[model samples]
Target: MVQTFLPHPPGARLALEDATRARTGSPVQMGLDELGTPLSQTTFVVVDLETTGGSPTSSEITEIGAVKVRGGEVLGEFQTLVDPGSPVPPMITVLTGITDAMLVGAPRIGEVLPAFLEFAQLGAGTVLVAHNAPFDVGFLRAAADRMSLPWPRVQVVDTVKLARRVVTRDEAPNNKLGTLAALFGATVTPDHRALHDARATVDVLHALLARMGPLGVTHLEDLVTASDPVPHQRRRKSHLAEHLPGGPGVYQFLGPRREVLYVGTAVDIRRRVRSYFTAAEKRRRIGEMVDLAEEVRAVPCTTALEASVRELRLIAEHDPPYNRRSRRPERRPWVRLTDEAFPRLTIVRQVTPDDDAIGPFSSRRAAEECVEAIQEAFALRRCTPRLPRLARAGASACVLAEIGRCGAPCTGAQDVPSYAVVAGAVRACLREDAEPVVAAVHARIATLAVQERFEEAAVQRDRLRSFLVAARRTQRLRPLWRCPELVAARRAADGGWELVLARYGRLAGTCLVPRGVDPMPAVEALVATGEVVAAPTTAMGAASSEETELLADWIEDPATRLVRWDESDTPLACPVRGAARHAVPARG
Candidate 1:
């Protein structure tokens, strides 16, 4: 999610800067107070594309509109509607005032792409401006990628970001292009159309440039490069204020030898400053940051734009371990099979987003092929959640458990091995045969009644029936499909063996294998080897009889390519799967 923070209004910043300049004969800390910003005197084009409707998938682009500004003046413009090659909705036509008739004689996207590209790159290099550049850019990128057309690396600027820095949060809380233009005292024309918005964007930009003063910032790069402010304030005497004035920007608290101790911010100047300097105030988050503070300093902005920029910059610059700690900490659930010895193959959560828990296979392949590992390993009900209270081990569990169908928790003796099996089974049922899982509730109740545990069993029996009634309406039995196995199958950057897969095989009817184990450690055996074919079936050299001995060759191999990226070539991502996207790879 590309979140946006409103920048101080340029007008407000300009007002403050003007006041400062009037008093000190120099620019004080204003957003556009120039240090170095990319400058271009060439024509700048602010563009927008209105789709047939809002959705990118169902709706298609209906109009492309733009306005050109050059040498602080308005140039020629472009606006056209292309037949979306689909049925247009009435609501869309009503909103955009663009009817099917209007687009019937219009050009197609193929012709439109080249035209826009030509207009954007009129001369040698051109600047493309968009209020929300990424949204427009995403479309352009997707369209280009789809058409296999190369998009020129033209300079681009996102006015939304610019406005955030230029406007104070309160001044322009709403940073919509139309809202911004109106805030700038520009005419508020009817909006939601492509061309009007672009024209208004140009007007707003011109007003900002005029207020910002001469830099010949024609392109978006110039505006951005220019946005970086210069610090020219008189150096502070030791005792006074060494920190940045209470302004909205990023802050860094440096420790001895410039080590970063803590990084944080305060919305209020005196409060944030007090949090650092005052003994009582310096206890919690601020206290921690202040304790390590050798130097306290900051950049000032009228809005959170500077704050966000500085925060991200400091995080990248310092690379503080504590700062980037994962919110979703690494903690995998394990079924220990307490019955087994030290090297018990535990079933852990599948790190992948697939439904692969259905296994107690001879191999990962068998689980992927069999698709019952989830049920066998977890003992999850075929399709329904376990009944309440029944989940807690007790006498009820004993009655059901006595029948051999369940690993009961009710009585003193719970089947430890069966518990492990059922746990994996439950996971599998949920993953694959969801509806059948609910159907198994009857099976649970039936087992409970065999021991004359009628009361306890009957209550469960009723709940299971209700559950089944509810579940059948919602979860239909879908085809049991196997999730793709996209394991990276890593080898260590340094040589070593990882006993990732404890062992894959079966005991009794319940085939048991360690599900959701990290394959990286096991692949450590593969080392730097690029292609790993299954180990050759060879006569035992006596040493080969031992798993340790079997791992010797891989343990010894160093120059082998241990791991490869599962998808595109990138370093292995760890914490492999969780509630978040794009996790950092786990350290050994």
Candidate 2:
């Protein structure tokens, strides 16, 4: 049977239950009020344990002490000597001042653990406090495991972790229990015994609490989050994540009028969004975005990649104020193969219906660099603007012809039929075979090296690398765009497969296969229920380059596994001999 106790002054012993309460109607409700429970109202069980050794698995607890407090009043205290069922090492005996003889007739851990659990009120609204909690808790858990007893699910506060966040090195020499105990001027000094050390930790706890108040640490969650020290703006928006579900998904921060301010993905949305309100969130723009956020909305996805795709799509659609890359595909430059008799490689902001485009490159400068590399690699016509057949036949060859950079197509010197051979090589390079262009660039680099133009050769080498990187990126992604319909699956982080269906290169459906379950049913259900977003119908849709490029990017990730494609005759796979492998810097 458990004995009842009432709150009392510091160092006061537990009071006996009143006999008058037996005559009363019912047992008085002992719970504290729920609305914003103050630190004064919340009970703290400051705990300390003396163990035979550090490793809980190999060691055993020799003694345990805890002081229960509420509003700084001593509610109760528990102290016990435990029979560890093992020999105490000599060093442990010297350090803790505990010996095997003292525990000769003490209660075993099985009897001690349950009684201590009851005394500490191990349930909701109660928090466990310790100087170095992990050490004590580890032993407690080990004892519980040994007895086949369930450890209480209680919130634990490590004063050491808290002290590091709140106390500066200048204020305290170190965060050790003894140093902090003396620094805070506790009522009892810690002397290796359990109860005395617990009393000291209580004083340190109150000192840290006082320091935390000025720093806007009000709620328990705030107190816990203070350990990381996130941006100041994050604290003001802590309520934004109050209702977010903890799951894999995309989260959108919305401004006034429901305008999206930012879009992101997280394996655990609640934790990720709450992290923004902590000091650990260091992104400068995201901090500003959090300040502007009025509401947050979470959309759960089947897998991380699905969440990633959804985030990218939302970012593309809303062009959220804080998002930087992948926001405006229309503005991103593409490598355009002009539809002229003597076609020239050029970088354009948008792809036209008639143009044979190769990119939705990251930037205009990058696209220009790729065009330059391709021009160096192949003898494509270097003339700008459309070249008429008649004009090309009459025009004089430029000085570039003397350097062998071009086939002199502006003049009749190189006939259209003869020049088509080099043009065919350019076409093949753009379509898939990047080997010819890569080889040409290598040859040029070697020639420049032979001429002792090392700096120029380095520039050529960098250009070749840039060209190959872009070519490989586009090459990897191009097939996903070309396919009419596709089904693919990739292992989700949660030990399941994430299935995705695309129609005309746009995401049509997605679903998850729970662990240990067949995925085919979910895949069929998703395909049946999912909506096919119509592709852009303007010159944009005619290009089919941007959407396809995005799809290719998602598919290129090594984790993604393709299950099916619409064109069975044309399987979707990486090119056997593409520029991807050629771009690697050779080992010396």
Candidate 3:
């Protein structure tokens, strides 16, 4: 997702240069500010294609025409006839005034496509415009793909969509190229030929943009967004995003009683929050969520990672009605080593204080895979929950026990003292010492491959990879538990720094330092106002692995600089030989 954010302050409208500078260091930030890019600076490529027939798959490009312009001045032009490699239909010839003789010696589509692509991308940033964008762009993409050429990543604008949004039917009879050209009094009229139609569409594009100027559609992104039709009822509530800050932050949609409806994070809170009310919002449930929302709230953060972590925390805290995922944290399954006489591995939701838990995995299946990998490493009991206290004297043993895959404590075939060593090794593997389990899994994978059971081997490989990822994540985060205070800084776009302070892995306070500002006073003020977060008492809520991982990611970002810490040494460092790093190899 290409997330967008405004600059430093949340509520202030920024000048183009200022907004650009503010978002410089952040990767997710993109130009969405209404006035960020001037109309005069943008390049527009008006394109039109006369194809053999309707479908690009069946029909081929008969002619290609385009005009490049910037600030109303035509910079260059492209026009070509393509040998479509098929007979041009009589109906298409009558409509476009191009016949077989006209294209007799013209370059084929394969030869024409590359030159067309180069022409379309003549400017630093180009937006392709057409009467009906999909038709022209579709044919171009189809022809390019047939030649095994990569399609250009250019923004496309449809004059039809633009006219539907900006001009009422009362002003224009209909949204056809000819009708629109006459209605807008365009000097160049559509003559059905590619070049003439493209020129006419160019005029229509300018006309639509002129109509959009009053709606605050100054930047290219703003223009594209405005072209989307928004629900009338929803448009009235767009005021909720009017004052949202432009920087990285989490935003919440609130209901009548200040209840959180949906929680989301964005690099540009205003742009993202405002999108919920637009026609581009296709999710039916989200439209329903917006209908219930009475207000929108913004909480600023220093970086994209911080926004993500804050979103997780907020979702967990509120368990909001509209939020479907991450709201029910208790529902996320974890792989736990049961605290019974035969300590078998199990997939569980509720985490008791005595249980050793590995994760709040995305699903029960993932947690099951982790447990299966651990069991494969050590022949732990694979019986159903709560096995007979001493195993029924004459009970039947399952195939797993017969195959030596399980210790078979359920059938009295294995004793508790003997099982203890396997369970202990499993615990060791789940914690830091993962070599024993890794080697065992590698051997199993090798044996399965030797037996030509490649599918089963792939499954085992994934399982082992899952266990290693969780175990390494836990080990890397273990040190943060001992630290009382942690503080770090990331450089801002304007030569300043943003500060983050956490106490015992919980975010406490944040402050920003402009390039030359004194840091001491602001630091003191921030710490004084910072809230003291209490540690989680429940095993399910312990450590908030998601937040810790987010923090670790933020700390590791190259833009950040360590400012101050209450501890003598920073415990947050990436492990050199961690299993997580070793699990995947870089492809050449």
For residues 424-540, write the lDDT of model 1, one tens digit per residue. 544433333443433444465567789777776655544433323222211211110110111122232233222211111000010011344444443443232222223222111
lDDT of 2 by residue, 214-276 (tens): 665655666656666564456757767755656577888888777889998999887788778
Give the top-scoring candidate (TM-score): 2
| Candidate 2: pairs in clash | 229-279, 230-278, 230-279
The better candidate by TM-score, 1 or 3, is 3
Q: Give lDDT per model, in order.
A: 0.45, 0.73, 0.74
Give, for candidate 2, the lowest lDDT window spanning 10 residues. 1-10
Tens-digit lDDT string for candidate 3 (363-400): 77768777887877788877766865588778887888
Quality of model 1 by C-alpha lDDT: 0.45
Model 1 weakest lDDT span, ten residues long: 503-512
Where model 2 places Cα greater than 4 Å from the true spot, the runs are 1-194, 206-224, 231-233, 255-258, 352-354, 391-394, 448-454, 489-497, 513-525, 533-564, 568-570, 581-588
Q: State every prediction's TM-score relative to the real structure.
A: 0.34, 0.68, 0.64
Between prediction 1 and prediction 3, the one with superior lDDT is 3
